[model samples]
Target: MRDTLDNLYTLDTLATFTPGVFYQFLMTKTQQFRFVKLGERFSSICGLPVAALLHDASLLFNCMTAEQRDELICDILHSSQHLTEFYGCIALTKPDGKQIWLEARSSPEAMPDGDIVWTGFVYDVTAREQALAQLAKSSELSRTILDNMLDSVVSINEQGIVIYANQTALSLFGYQAEELVGKNVSCLMGAHHASQHDQYLQHYANTKEQRIIGSNRVVQAKHKDNSLIPVELRICELDNAHGRSYLGVMRDLSHKLMQQQAIDQLTLQDALTALPNRTALNRRINQCIDNLALNPTQYCLICLDADDFKLINEGYGFEHGDEFLRQCARVLSDFGLYFLARTGEDEFAVLLETSEGRPSLEQQLGLIVQALAKPQQVFGDLISCNFTAGAFCFSTADFTYSDVVRSAELALHYAKSGGKGRIAFYDHRLDQHQRQHALLDQYLRTPDILSQFYLVYQPQYDVAGHLLGFEALMRWRHQEQAIAPDVFIPLAERNGAIFMLGKWLLQQACQFIRQAQKIPALAHCRVSLNISARQFASAHFTDEVLTEIRRSGITHSLLHLELTERLLLENPKDVVAKMQLLNRCGITFSLDDFGTGYSSLAYLKQLPLHELKIDKSFVRDLPVNSSDRSIVSAILLMAGGLDLEVIAEGVETELHRQSLQQLGCRRFQGYLYGQPMRAEHWLQH
Candidate 1:
């Protein structure tokens, strides 16, 4: 590090030069590097923008008990004396919870802004510590040093025969000291190197030049059990009065090698599901592409995602969300002889070998849906994981793996938007929506986007044509062009603008309800608002909602919080607790889009729910589709048993409403009553 520092600039210039250039130096050695200024608030560090930087407590530890960790934290964050400077080795716990040795130094300077700039250099000393610990076994020092070593040691005569064998060597090679006394030293190394040792020694004797005689290297060694073990060998050549001898030390690096391999795996494998991650998956696809030139095999890439999976993570907690991923991974891995990869939080890809005689892509998709469509039990909660698959069948026409993969991804969006558990196929003809993602991302960040956003209320009616209320739906218009919720919502969520948008939505909904109370026709009516899983998963979501409700002064029992069944499964106790807390405030809760998600009998009885809204997909073909009618009938019967009111959405025709009425559905929402309109238009109507 001093060498790198001197090569770059002098000590006097350190203040002027940015540390980002020096970061390349640290990356060559270790990845454990960070620097902070006092009053790190409202500032960026280490090339990280303010929005992307992790909090100090999160990067370090907030609840650490280790003395070294505590000491370091105190030195940097809460030092008593002005925290002038500190230079030493300390134990650093990485964000991944890995405890590693670190050699670090920090110099803090008090700035005019009442801030202290603490510039520091960090390096992981774990490998150095391990290497130092191995030096005793890796040197040709005194006998005391040899005896203290954990590795094996042996001495060989001019004839390449063993003259001395330490106890460690005897124990390691499964040979008795007496038996190995006159044996050839080549027995230790495997046959590959053993066969050439004598010739190499003779050549060295003739040439008087050394290749490996004084070097440290790793080689395959034969153990007494006839098993091959990786061992680090260091050799010292000695030429005494009579002839030449070699002092060789061997350290067992099997454990260290295994650790290195495990570390290597993290680059390409998912830590949560133990499946191949995006990098590995993309590599596999590239390999398949390369092989296609010769093999010409027919294959298809299916990119599938769990519908509304974000809600689980948001509603229950990240821990529960991880468990849900594990279950999904387990199910996907169960499929026969397919390359499965987790590409995103809820998205997965399967490279299936779909030749002529094999099962068709649709058949395979059906099997996957059938297997994963069942309710999963996570932390004693019944959660559903239904797959929406987008498939792209490839042939000789596809030149690159990205081409097919991108097409598959495009198809996946269609599948998700088409309906729950549906499949969308993307061929060469369909235009990819990938280009719009960046544009949408940029547009969402524009000022006055909130003003361009609006709410359209779709009215809900009872059996006697009495107005019950309306469901508030969000819409966005960009330059007079109406953008679908499916497009902009994902962009906002990804870029972290959703938090602001979510608060805005809640405020508007509450204010609408609060003001609607003054109108005689809408005074006693219920107004429903949709809540995003991401918004609800926040740490202070319930408090945020309650605060907005209070600020809006909506004290009447006119507000209803609508959520999907999958959302109800995440942190059920917490959800129920929050529901019960708000229920006391006259706010009602309803399970929205029912019959499309995983709903269990156990969770239903525990929720303080007022109604169940059957999804439009079930009610779309109610009069003609018997299958849809049967599903509606089953849902109505289940709601009837639980004493919950059932509302049918998308009742366009008179026959659709009549069918739902006969099925005992009391409330309706569709074009038959009224299409969604602006608040003023609907109010005037």
Candidate 2:
């Protein structure tokens, strides 16, 4: 009995100091409320003494409102009948009028007397209750704001389950707000992205590494109809009551992307031809250059232009010219090359992936050139147009986009300038050739260019070592730089400057012939000068030669005009007419480089030619090469039958001279006799 009293005293001591009120109560079978026990702090918490509470538990109800009193009685009755736990939170006013919140939790037991006894505690939870009410109000406000936002907002749990989606998000994804609340976030994603989304979340959870969070990304979102919508999404990590979640704010990007693509198309295409323009070609070239490092492959850039396109513009109108260009673009497109673009007014550029090597590429290019030559329809007229192309091939990574384009353009220039309707390939040698051509073109355009030119005389001799005549060779000196006849003459002929230069050559040679006539021994010696195809083809050529000879007052028979076999290759009738006109006036004609070019006996027999000059190639090997010897013999025999004089050129040694004599050649012009020298030097010698 003493130990039991000691335990009761220990329990009373523990309850008095404990926070709030600890109590035990009961409801009798007769439905009478009674207090079993109450803590000393019940007075401090409920404004009632512990003994007063134990005597009548109704005294504790006095601290609560009338509603609280009724609720407490009903709970007591229900707990007695059901023997269930009793829990309640109620607002109370103390005797001093201090307002507070009280929370109670209790477990009831059925007594042997059919009464239910309760053991529980009630605590003042005013601060926590107020805070929770405020939080609920704030949450309602936040939800209202998110639902009305222009941008879609969504919240997902760490496991990627959609916990919350605002009205805008539901609309953007074509879903109702309730439909999206419990679904996995991947439902709004395409198959590929959906398959990997779980793995991405799992990786983030394991590593805490951020790949998409805290950064805005452009991604494709799937709508309810299975159509893809572009979206700009920003994901943020949110720490909430449910552990880590993600809040994604997204904006639709579909319209903006479409607008940008329209702008890019305008910037990268030709307005008239409807083909990719220079800017687009440049961009593609840069992309190719960038990829060359990763994948090494050959690239061939063909810069081509419609040959004689200006005639189309002149013959037809500019509108027709434009239509022709468009038609040309279509035909080139049909060739099915890698890339095509309009680079100039009548020019187009094609980029070829040259995996098939240069020969096959060339063959393909040849077919394109040929196909373009077949007539195309432009404004109801079947106009045939030809294309001249210049191509540059490269596999090295060191070339820039501009370098490749410029090289191809250089090849194009070479092709067009050489003669239209052909394809030219660019090489290192061609690069050097173009540089020289540009410099020569600049110099040749000068006003005083004729003053820079002069003639050298290479003596032509007989078998008796007597001077038969002199071949007047043209040379140029541009401020101490010597330009060879083979170099500047072709450039001059193509540029139409050969007319001026040819007139000067004729005047100079005629004057030399006049000077020779003053010397009795050299008076009969014929002076030979070369005639270019351009010069020979001139309508005024026959008159020009007759006028030069007449103005010189020298014997017309003493002047010999040298023609190449290339002249006979075209317009034989015109060539014969020009030769016959000059021959009738006592001027002679010799076929220069006879065996080296289009040697047709048909055209050879029709010409009024006096001599044939054996090109150095056939004479270089002399007796050493049997084929060359045989070729030289054949040429000599052919010349003999035609009653034409044969002069062996490039005779440098006694063996060469002796071999030509054995072949029945009487005349020769070579370094063995004398090299070409200035007119004054030859006169003094």
Candidate 3:
């Protein structure tokens, strides 16, 4: 029976033991048996006070297997710490995987064998281990949900102090979770928002309200490196048991701002030159005018228009023209302290600021003229084009910025009308006259003006007083009045009507050539027609002259083309080449107004010429002015040396002719012989 009881305890079979067996064992016991007090020591396993074992406990003398008793002893020894402290019985497993249990007095005492024992109960712990595994699974699931959340869950108190932050929040702020836990939310608000931040919080605290809660608002935040970054922040209030808190989610805005700035810059600037375009120019001008209004000092506005700019474009093509304009802009920028802008295709404007009550305006104007007069080389062509500028100075007594600009433009028109390469200051008289001239220029382009244009032949005679040839001079017989070539020629050039007018003159001259050929006396003489500078620059001029000659069926040698010295000087190489080509084709060239330009003996030698026409200015007082006499004498000597013919133009007096004839000038044309007259009149004479 003792062995069976030990086996039951060892096998954890206490519940399977029958109550009848316990009674039988108790009755069969030879010693007194009684319930001992519950185990006295506190139980480490059950966490309950040990009960004393009952008194008069029954002791059976029945023998048991040594293995069973050994098992009981092992359990007692294994659990001795708890058992000796008067706790319930405890069991343990040995390294061999053997199970054991112990039962003895609740308060075990040391026996003569020097061993301690305890009485208690034993049970298995497998069910408790299973319960612990279930708890761990639940805890892991809660942690996984918190870590994977997308929203930057930054927890802050009502005072805007950060308490807890998730991985998302830490990453957004460029910080670790531990670094941000105690930081104040205001630390991230940029300096620009620092002052207003307290008010915002105060308002929120007073009203229990939130401005950006659950909605996006632009805000600034500082990164871990202390750089300010723009962000779109969305805050949500959390109603947790831990009191009022806020969760913030921030989105960066650096990329959006960069894109917007790029678009703005591209829209405001010119892509080709990177200069401010018209839109930006207008804005800047307006701003400058506004600022100028405050001081009301002298401000000058000048407008520049390139002379014969169209010729350049037509000669070199538009691509070259564009490059030319860019180069011009770079050169123009060298002028100091001026607001220079390209206002039209070949027109530019400069706004100048002057000192108070200074009379240096004229000096400044001269400087500007000098700067513009400098030659520019474009596309391997040495271009010496000139500009006509019109200037207007602002006075509190007179005009606003707009009015000044308009006045300057009018003056520019006047300058161009007077003759190119000149500057005109704004004047009311000139402006009115310019308007009338503009109207006349418009009328001159009509067919009536074209048909009314006629030529008069000025008779040329040799020193022997025999008729040589007649120079055809263009005259415009306006229906209302007569206009001089000097006035209308420039107008025609300005309006680009010179091309057509020049062709008409050439054809008229050709007709005169045929008429002269029919006349017995003048048939042997060659007729000369003066070609304008504008005509020489025209692309189709050569073809037009050739066509007229062919239509007339007159010999090319009979038609002499006269060009002024100024025309040759304008583009010397081109002029020389063109004249050489025509000379090769049996046409003659006469250098008219020879002494009026920068005449070089070297150039004269190189030029293809048959005659040198002395300008009327020198010939008008030829025998009186020693300078004029010396020039005429020198020219005649030079022409003789070069084997070139000499024609004395503007021969208004008999002495003028006599003096020129004495100098060996063989040809002469002027009022002394006969004033320019119609071809019919020349035939009648």
* Candidate 2 positional error at 404, Å: 1.5
**lDDT by residue for model 2 over 324-380, one digit each (tens)?**
888888988988889999988888999988788778988989998998889878779
Worst 10 residues of 3 by lDDT: 18-27
TM-scores for all predictions: 0.48, 0.53, 0.49
Tens digits of per-residue lDDT for model 3, 87-120: 2223434334543333222223222233432233
| Candidate 3 off by > 4 Å | 1-281, 284-298, 303-358, 364-390, 396-403, 409-424, 429-441, 491-496, 516-519, 532-558, 565-587, 597-608, 621-627
Instruction: Give me the candidate number with maximum TM-score.
Output: 2
What's the true lDDT of residue 473 in model 1? 88
lDDT of prediction 1: 0.72
| lDDT sort, best first | 2, 1, 3
Compute the lDDT for candidate 2.
0.81
Candidate 2 matches the true fold with a TM-score of 0.53
Residue pair clashes in candidate 2: 43-48
Task: Name the lDDT value of residue 462 in candidate 2.
Answer: 91
Model 2 regions more than 4 Å off: 1-226, 230-283, 292-398, 408-429
Segments of candidate 1 deviating more than 4 angstroms: 1-426, 429-431, 445-447, 490-495
Q: Score each candidate by Cα lDDT.
A: 0.72, 0.81, 0.66
